[model samples]
Target: MGRAPQKVRNRDTNPCIDEGDASLKCLDEHNYDKSCCSAHFQRYKNCRKYWHSVMLQRRGDGVRPDMPTAAERQELLDAIGGKPY
Candidate 1:
């Protein structure tokens, strides 16, 4: 058997991982039918959008690492005064 969707690791260290995992799970459950997972797709897209904006803002501020690592993300969340997701 293949690995469970929840067990899929985020080696990329990008943001919105939970949304990505949910989309994967939806696709798995629906036999890879994209139409059946539209909501999950939309959510993942929105998450990418939100994080991209944050990345751009940080870049403008001259912060290194346009995309934050996992540990940096928690500091970012604290700095931003709450979690976006």
Candidate 2:
């Protein structure tokens, strides 16, 4: 009988993004160094732009442009049968 084939271990292997060295020939063709091109390094610039938009919206204070006036506040209070303190 032929000997059984050895089982290969997959747990220790790193994915294409985490390898940190360009083992694939195609990345070398594009002059991209895996050590520098990992997604962790490239993600910050995209995230920063999104965060900047969120911060700008927060800085606008929660008031809408067509907000109500003091009369509206009194009407609301009267409807509830009480005035705001």
Best by TM-score: 1
1-85: candidate 1 lDDT, tens digit per residue:
9975653356344778788899999999999999999998988898888889978998999988777877887787799897664
Q: What lDDT does each candidate get?
A: 0.81, 0.42
Best by the lDDT measure: 1
Residue 1 of model 1: what lDDT? Answer: 95
Candidate 2 lDDT over 1-85, as tens digits, reads 8997643332122112222232344367557666755554444344334334534564576644222333553465489786222
**Model 2, C-alpha of 54: deviation from truth (Å):** 0.4
Candidate 1 ranges with C-alpha deviation above 4 Å: 1-12, 78-85
Candidate 2: clashing pairs of residues: none
For each of the candidates, the C-alpha root-mean-square deviation to the true structure, in angstroms, is: 7.2, 23.2
Question: Each prediction's TM-score against the native?
Answer: 0.68, 0.27
